[model samples]
Target chain A: MVEIKNLTKRYGGNVALHGISFDIKDHEILGFLGPNGAGKSTTMNIIAGYLPSTSGTVTINGFDITEQAADAKRCIGYLPEIPPVYPDMRVEEYLTFCAGIKGIKRPDVKPQVESAMERLHITDMRRRLIRNLSKGYKQRVGFAQALLGNPKILILDEPTVGLDPAQVSEVRALIKELGKDHAVIFSSHILAEVSAVCERVVIITKGEIRAIDTIEHLERSMTANTLLNLTVEGEKDTALRILKDIRGIKEIKYLNAADGRVSCQLTLEDESVRNEIMSALMANGCNIAEMSMAKLDLEQVFLKLTAQKEKRSSLQDLLDETPDVSGEAPQDAANDTTE
Target chain B: MFALYKKELQAFFYSPFAYVLTALFMLIFSFGFITSIANMDSNTLKFSFPEFFYNNFFYFIFIIPLLTMRSFADERRGGTEVLLYSSPLSVTQIVLAKFLAIVTVFLFMIVLSLFFPIYAACTGKVIWSALICAYAGFFLWGLVCIALGMLLSSLTGNAIIAAIIGEIVMEGLLFLDQVAGSRLVDAYPHLNSVVTWFSMQRRFVYFSQGMFRLEDLVFFLSVTALVLCWNVLSIEKRRYSHA
Candidate 1:
C-alpha cells in the first residue's frame, strides 16, 4: 500500500537518510529496526508527509505525497515519537477532532471516535483531560487517534517507548491485530519487540540499510557458521591453546572462568567441527563438562549485521597506501619489547 | 479546516484566556468612555465615540498579540504541529483557520465594547453613522494587527517571545506614524509620502473623520492579506528546512 523510492533526507550538511527504499504491502507488518539517531523518525516523518524529503518520493496508495498531499495523507494514520496530543483537551473531544480532520463524515465521527476509544480500552478516560492521564494512557490515546480514520497505512514511531511491559504487550497485540487489514510499520531499537511482532524486519544503522529479511531468514543465515559453547574443567590457558589449535575454529571468545572451569564460545566452519574439537579436548585431558551447538538468534543476527558496517578510519587507509615506511620499523621493534 | 478552526476557538473560549482578555477589553473601553464624558466640552456638551476609539487604539493593540501568541507557537512547542501537518489540510488552510479563529476572538472583544456606545446613546445624544464607521475602521485595523500577530507567532516558536516581539513591532508601526508627522520627515516630500503611505494610523484618521475612502479599505485589507500570506510561507519554509 506504500512505496518509498530512493528516499533521502539531508539536514543542511548532515544526511539523515541516504537513498533508502522500502515498500509495505497490504496487510503486512513491517518492522523498522534501528538504534537512536538512525533516521527512523526521519523516514517515518517523510512517509507521513510531515517533513518533505530532500530527494526521492513517497507514494501512498498510488498518490504522490508532495503532488497529492491531501489524498496521500488521508490514507495514512501517523503516531509520531511524541503523541502529538493537546493536553488540555479531553480524550473524547480530541479523538473526535482527529476524526473530523481526517475528513470523516459528520455523522460517522462519533461512531469512529467511540470505536477507537473502545479499541484502545480508553473508553473510561473519555471525559478526563489528556494531561491528567498517565503516560501509558496518553500513548494509547495517540494510538487511538491513529485508528480513527481507519486508514490503510499506519506509521507508528516507537509506540512502546514509555509504556510498561503489560502496556507494551497490549500495544504489540493491537499492532498485530491492526496488521490483519492494514499495512502497519512500527519502528524500535528493541530486538525482541521486533522479533515478537514483526514478520519481516528492516535493520538500519548510520543512515544505511544493513539488512532486510524475515526474522527466520536472517537467523538461519547466521546459523550456517555454527557457534559452539564449550565449558571445560582444565587450566584456562591449556584449554584455550587446545581450542586455538583446532583447524575448523574460525574465532574463539572467552566467556568466563571460575574454579578451574573455563567456558568459551567457538565459531566453527561447519557443524562437523564439534566432533573434532571434542576429541582433541579429551586427548589433552581437558574434561568437557558441557557442550552445545548454539544457533544465532535474532539479537545476534541484528548485532552482526549492524556491527559489520564500522566506518574505516583515514589513518588505516593512509597506512594501507604506504606500507613500507622506514619510520614504522623502529616503532614495531619497540612495541615487541613492551609486549 | 473547520474542525481546526473550532478547536482553536475552543482553545480560547474554553480556557480562562478569552474571558480574561474580554474583561480587560471592556475595562479599557469603559475607562475611555467615562473619561471622554467627564472631559466633554462645557460649551457643546459633545462626546464623540470616534475620538474615544482613536484614543483607545493604543491600549487595545496590546491585547491582540496575546490573543494570537499561542496560535502556532503552542502547536509547535507541544509537538502538535505534526498532527496538523499530517492532516488532510493544506498549509494555507491551516494558516487561514488559525487567523480566522483569532479574528473571531478579536471580533468578540469589539462587540463587547459596543455596550459603552449603547449605554451612552440611552443617556445622551449619539452619532450612529460616524460611530459605525469608527467601529468598521477599528475592526479593519485590528484585522491587520491580528494577521501580523499570527505571523509573529509562526516565526517564533515561543509564545512569550512572539508576544514581546509583536508588541515591539506594533509599537514601531505607531512610532512610524509619529515619524511621518514630524517636521524632519515633512521637510522631505518624497520620504513623507512613503512613510505616510505605510502609516496605518493616518489611514485610520480618515476613517475616524467619517470618510470611508476605498483607498484606506483596500490598504488595510491588502496589508492584512500580505501578512497572512507571509505567515503561510514561513510555516511551509520551516517544514522544508526543518531539522
Candidate 2:
C-alpha cells in the first residue's frame, strides 16, 4: 500500500537519508529497524507527507505524497517520535479534534473517537486533561489520535518509547491488532519488539538499508556457524578427547556445568557435522542427557549484519593503510547498545 | 480549521493566560475610560468616539502581541506541533484557525470595552456609527498583529524569542510611521507613505475618523492575509525540511 522510491534527504553536509527505497505491502506490519539517525523517522515523515524528501517520491495507495498530499495523508495515521499532544485539552477533546482534522464528519466523529480510545485502552483517561496524564497515557493518546479516521496506513515512529514494560506490551499488542486490517509501518530501535510484532523487518544503518527479510530468514542468512550445547555426564578431559576425534568438527569450547555434569559448546563448520557429532558421542559411550543448538536470534543477526558492514569499511581502511576506521571501532561498538 | 480553532480556544480558556489577558484589558479600558470621563471639559462638544479610540489603539499594540505570541510558539515548544503536522489538515487551515482563536479572545476584550462607551454615552450622546467603524478598524488591526505574531512564533520555537520578535516587529511598524512623518531628512518620501500604510495606528486613522475608505480596508485585509499566508508556507516548509 506504500511505495517509496529514490528517497534521499540531507541536512546541510550530513546525509540523513540516502536514496533508500522500499515497499510496504497491504495489511503488512513492516518494522523499520535502525539505530538513531538511520533515517527511520525521516522516512516516516516523508511517507506521512509531513516532510518533503530532497529528491524522491512517496506514494500511498497510488497517490504521490508531494503531488497529492491530502489524499496521500488521508490514508495515513502518523504518530511522530515525540508524542504530539496538547496538554491543556482533555484526552477525549484532543482525540475529537484530531478526528476533525482528519476530516471525519460530525456524525461519525464520536464513534470513531470512541473506537480509537478503546483500541489504545485510554477510555478511562478520556476525561482527564492531558497535562495531568502520565507519560504513558500521553503516548497512548497520541496513538489514539493517529488512529482517527480509520486510515488504511499507520506510520508510527518509536511508538512505545518511554512506556513501562506493560504499557509497551499494550501498545505492541495494539499495533499487532492494527496490522490485521491496515498497512502498518513502525520504526523501532528495540530489535526484539520489532521481531515479535512485525511480519517483515527492514534493517537500516547510516541512511542505507542493510537488510530486509523475515525474522527467521534474516537469522538464518546472517548465521555463519551452528552452535551446539551438550551436557555429558562424563569426565571433561575424556569427553573433549572423544569429541576431538569426530570428523568435520571445526571448533569446540567448554561452556559451563552444574553438579557432576559437564557441558561444552561445539561449533560445526557444516550442517552434516551435527549428526556426525551425535553418532560420535553415542559411539564414545558418553551419557548425553541434554543437547541444545543455539541459533542466531534477531539481536545476534542485527549485530552481525551491522558488524559485517563495519568490518567491510575497516577492510577498506586497511587497504588504504589509514587508521580512522580503527579509531571509530570503540565508538560504533558503544553506539550499538546505546541506540 | 474548526478543530484547530476549538482546541486553541479551549487551551486559552483552560489556562490562566486568557483570564490574565482579559483582566489586564479590563483594567486598561476602565482606567482609560475613567480618565477620559473625569477629564472631559465642557468646551469640546463635538468630541466623538473615533477621537477617543484613536488615543487608545496603542493598548492593542501591547495586548495584541501578548495574546498572539504564544499561539504557535507554545505549541512548538510543547511538541504539539507534531500532532498538528501529522494530522490531515493543511498548514493553511491550522494557521488560520489559530489566528482566529486568538482574535476570539481579543474580540471578547473589545466587546467588553464597549461597556465603557455605553457608560460614557449614558452621561452624554456619542456617535455610534463612528464607534462601530473604529471598532472594525481595531479588530482588523488586531487581526493583522495576530497574523504577524503567529508568523513570528513559527519562525522560532522559543516562546520568549517569539514574544520578543513580535514586540519588535509591532513596535517597529509603529515607529516607522513616526519616522516617516518627521521632516528631519527627506530622503525617500514615497517609501515613507508605504511604511505609513503599514503603521497599525496610521492605518486605523481613517476608520476611527469615520471614513470608510476601500484602500484602508484592502490594505489591512491584505496585510493580514499576506502574513497569515507566509506563516502557513514557512511552517509547512520547516515541517517538510525536518521530515
Candidate 3:
C-alpha cells in the first residue's frame, strides 16, 4: 500500500536519512526499529507528508506525496511522536475535528469518532478536556485520532512511548488488530516491543538500514556462533586451560570469579564441544557449577547489527587513510617500561 | 478545511480569548463614541462617524495582532502543525482557514462596534452612506493587518513574540503614512508618489470621504492577498527546511 523509494532527508549539511527505501504491504505491521536520533521520526514524518524529503519520492496508494498530497494524505493516518493534539479541546470534539480534517463525511464523522473512542477505550473521557487526561489516556486519544478515517496506512511514531506496561500492551494489541486491515509502520527503540508485535523488522542506525528481516530470521542468523556461558568451581586458570584445549571452542572471554566459582563466556564452533569440555573439566577436578547455551535474542541481534555498522565504518576509514600511530608508539613503549 | 476553520474559531470562542478581546474592542469603540459626541462642534452640533473610526483605528490596530498572534504560532508551538500539514488539506487551504477564522473574529468585533452608531442614530442624526464607507475601509484595512499579523505569527512560532513583532510592524506601517506626508517626502515628487501609493492611510482617507474607488479597494485586497500568500509560503518553507 506504501512504496518509499530512495527516500533521503537532509537538514542543511547533516543527512537525516540517506536514500533509505522500504515498502509496507497491505495488512502488514512493519516495525521500524532504531535508537534515538536514528532518523526514525524523520522517515516517518516524510512518509506522513509532514516534512518533505530532501530527495526521492513517497507514493501512497499510487499517489505521489508532493504532487497529489491531498489524495496521498487521505490514505494515511499519522500519530506523531508528540501526539499532535490540542489540549484545550475535549476528546470527542478533538476527534471529530480530526475526522473532519481527514475528509470524513459529515454524517459519518460521529460514528467514526465514537468507534475510535470505543476502540481506544476512551469513550468515558470523551467529554473531558484532553489536558486533564493522564499521559496514557492522552496517548490513547492520539491513537484514537489516527483510527478515525480508517485510512489504508497508519504511521505511528513511538505510539507507546509514555504509556505504562499495561497500556503499552493494550496499544500493541490495538496495533495488532489494526494490522488486520491496514499497512502499519510502528516505530520504537524497544526491541522487545518490536519482536512481540512485528512480523518483520527494519533495523536502522546512523541514517542507514543495518538489517531488514523477520525476527526469527535475524535471531537464527545471529546464532551461527554459539555462545556458551560456563561456570566452574576451581582455579580460574585451570578452568580456562581445560576449556581452551577442547576442539570446536573458538574464543573464551573471562567474566568474573567469586565464591570459588569462575565464570566465562565461551564461543563454540558447534554444540558437540559442550560434552567434550564438560568431560575434560571433570577429569581435572573442576566441578561444573553452571553451563548453558546463551541463545541470541532480538536485543543482542539489534545491538550486534547497529554496532557492526560503526565497526565496519571505522575499519574502512583505517583502510582508506591509515592514521599516524608512530607518535603514540613511543608513549606506549614508555608506559610499558614504567609498568 | 471548514473543519479546521471551525476548530480555529472554537479555539478563540471556547476559551476566554475571543470574549476578552471583543470586550476590549467594544470598550475602545465606546470610548471613541462618547468622546466624539462630547467633542462635537457647538456651532454645527455635528459628529462625523468617519472621523471617529479614523481616530479609533490607532488603538484598534493593536488588537488585530492579539487576535492573530495565536493563529499559527500556537499550532506550531503545541506541535499541532503536524496534524494540519499531514491532513488532506493543502498549505493554501490551511492558511486560508486560519486567516478566515481570525477575520471572523475581527468581523465580530466590527459588528459589535456598530452598536455605537446605531445608538447614536437613534438619539441624533447620522449619515449612513459615509458611515458604511468608513466601515468598509476599516474592515479592508483590518484584513491587511490580520494577514500581516498571521504572517508574523507563522514566521515566529512564539505567540508573545509574534504579537510584539506584529505591533512593531503595524506601527511601522502607520509611521510610513506619517513619513509619506512629511516635507522630506513631499520635496521629491517621484518619491512622494511611491510613498503615498503604499500608504494605506491615504487610501483610507479617500474611503472615509465616502469615495469608493476601485483603486483603494484593489490595493487593500491585493496587499491582503499578497500577505496571505506569503504566510502560506512561510509555512511551506518551514516544512521544507525543517531542522
Candidate 4:
C-alpha cells in the first residue's frame, strides 16, 4: 500500500508536482498517464525515495519515505525510465546482485534470481553481457531486476517504451501477472498500452492530476458527442444531404479519400440515433461499405483532459493581464474549483 | 552493503579496469623496489622492502585514482546509480562498501609486493621493526588515498573528471611538501610548521625512518577518516537537496 499526501516537488522556481495526493491500494495495477514534461517521472522518483519532495510526505506500508527510507524502500521496487543497468555485467550476475541488494536471504538468492529470469523469459540470456543485448532484451532484464525480492509495491516508469509490439505485449502480460500479488504503478504516454494493462488510470498533465478512474469511466465522463464513421460508394453531396436530414444529426464532415468512394464523419447529438442513421442510409441509394460508431479511444480522452487544462490556464493568463475588474470574479471562482 | 561490496569488487576484475590497475600497481612499486634496493646497495645502507614502499607512497598518486575513479563515476555514468539509490541500503553503506572494495584491491597489490621483501630476507638480514613501521605507514597512506579518491568519485558522474580530480588531490598532497619548501613556508617562516603538516610526503617520512609514533599514525588515520566522513556527508547532502 502507498499513501502520498499533498506531495509537492519543485526544482527551484519550477514546480514539478503541486500538492498532489493519491493512494494506491494493494494488488491494484494503476497506470500513470501523462505527456512529456508532465512530472510523471518526478513523482515516481519521489515515491521511490530517489528524490526528495519539496513538501508534504509519502508513506509505504506506514513507513515514511524521508524518515524511514530504508524500511520504506525495502517494500517497493522501482524501474526508472532509463533501465538502471551495468553494461559490462552479465544478466544473471546483475540480477543476483540486485537480489543481494534487496536483502534476499543468501541461500534463497539463486532460486529467486532464476524464478525472476524465468518470469521475464530471460533465462537463455543469463550468461550474456547486458551491453551486448538488444534494447528489448535490455528492457526485459531491467524489468527482471525490478521483480527481484518480490517486493509488495512495484513502481515502473514507461515499462513498455522502446519495445517491439510483441515485446510490449509480453511486458503487458508480465505486468498483468504481477498485479495478482503486487500493487503495480506503471507510467506511460502510450494510452492504449495503459488501458490494456492497468486496471485504473490516473491522467496527469502539467504537474497536476486531471482525473483518476477506470478506462470505461473516463470514456463515459468526457464523451458527449457520438461520432459515426461511414464509408459509402455514392456522391459525397448526396450522402451529406441525406445524413443531414436525419434527426439528431448535429454535423457532417467529408473525410479525405482517393479510392473513388465518399467517406464521411457524422457527429450525432445523441448516441441512440446511431441505429436510425444506419437504417436510413441502407434504405437510401447509398451502399454503406462500413458503418460503425466511432468510440472515444484513450488518446481522445487524454487529449481532451490535457487540452482542457491548457484552456483553463490560458484563460487565467488572459484574466490576469486584463485590467477589467468584471472578469476577475468568474476567473477566481474557476481557479478555486480547479485547485 | 556486503552485496554491493561483493558486486563492486567482482566488477573491478570482470572488466579490464581492475586487472590493468593491479598490474600497473605491481609494475610501479617494483620499479620503486628495485631502484630503492639498487641505491641502498651502492650506499651500503640497509633498506627494507616495506620501508622502500613507504618512501614511495607517492606512487598512490598514480594508483589510488585508478582503483577508485570508477567506483561511483562509472555507476553514475552508466545510470546504475538509480539501482543503488533505490535499494534499501543507505548512501553511507554504499559509499563505505565501494571504498572497502578499492582498499581490498590496493591490499592485494600490497600483498604482492611482499614477495620482494621475502626474496631480500633470503639473501640478506631484514630489519623487522623498520618493516613494521613501513607497512603501517604504507597501509594508512593507501587508506588516505582511497578515501580521497572516493570523495572525488562522488563529486561527478564523469570517470575522467573523477580520475582527474583524484589525481589532482593526491598529486596536490604529494606536492604540498614542495610548495611548503618553495613558496609559502619559505616566504613566511612563521607558517612553516603548520604548512609542513599538510605535506603527505613529510608525514610518511617519519614512518619510513622506522619511527612509529602514535601521533604520526593517528594523523594519517584521522585524514583517512576525515575524507571518508566528508564523502558520506556529501552523499547525504545531495540526497536531501534533491529530495
Which candidate ranks first by TM-score, i.e. highest?
3
Q: Write the per-residue lDDT of candidate 4 for residues B151-218, one digit (tens) a residue.
A: 88887888888988888888788777778777656777768877787776676778878888888878
What does chain B score (TM) in every candidate?
0.98, 0.92, 0.98, 0.90
Report how far residue A104 has shifted in candidate 4, in Å. Answer: 1.0
lDDT of 3 by residue, B98-206 (tens): 9999999999998988888898899998889999999999999999999999999999779999999999999999999999999999999999999999999899998
CA-based DockQ, model 1: 0.81
Q: Write the per-residue lDDT of candidate 3 for residues A208-306, one digit (tens) a residue.
A: 877677766654544544566778999999888888888888888898999999988777676678789888999999988877664444555566567
Give the TM-score comparing model 4 with the true structure, all chains together: 0.83
TM-score for every candidate vs. truth?
0.87, 0.84, 0.87, 0.83
Residue pairs with clashing backbones, model 3: none
lDDT of 4 by residue, A1-339 (tens): 899998988877788888888889999999998899889999999899888888999999899999999999999989999899888889999999999998889998999899989999999999999999998899889989898888999999998889998988889998999999999999999888888888788777888877777766654533433556668777777777788889887768687554657877766676678778767877887777766564443565566566554333222232223222212233332111100
Runs of candidate 3 exceeding 4 Å displacement: A222-225, A228-276, A280-295, A310-339
Which has the higher TM-score value, candidate number 3 or candidate number 4?
Answer: 3
**Candidate 2: misplaced stretches above 4 Å?**
A222-224, A227-297, A308-339, B45-47, B185-188
True-vs-predicted CA distance for residue A267, candidate 1, Å: 6.1
TM-score of chain A of each: 0.75, 0.75, 0.76, 0.74
Clashes of each: 0, 1, 0, 2
Model 1: per-residue Cα lDDT over B166-230, one tens digit each: 99999998899899999999999999999999998889888899999999999999999999999
> How well does candidate 2 score on lDDT at residue A83?
85
> Pairs clashing in candidate 2?
A51-B240
Clashing pairs in 1: none
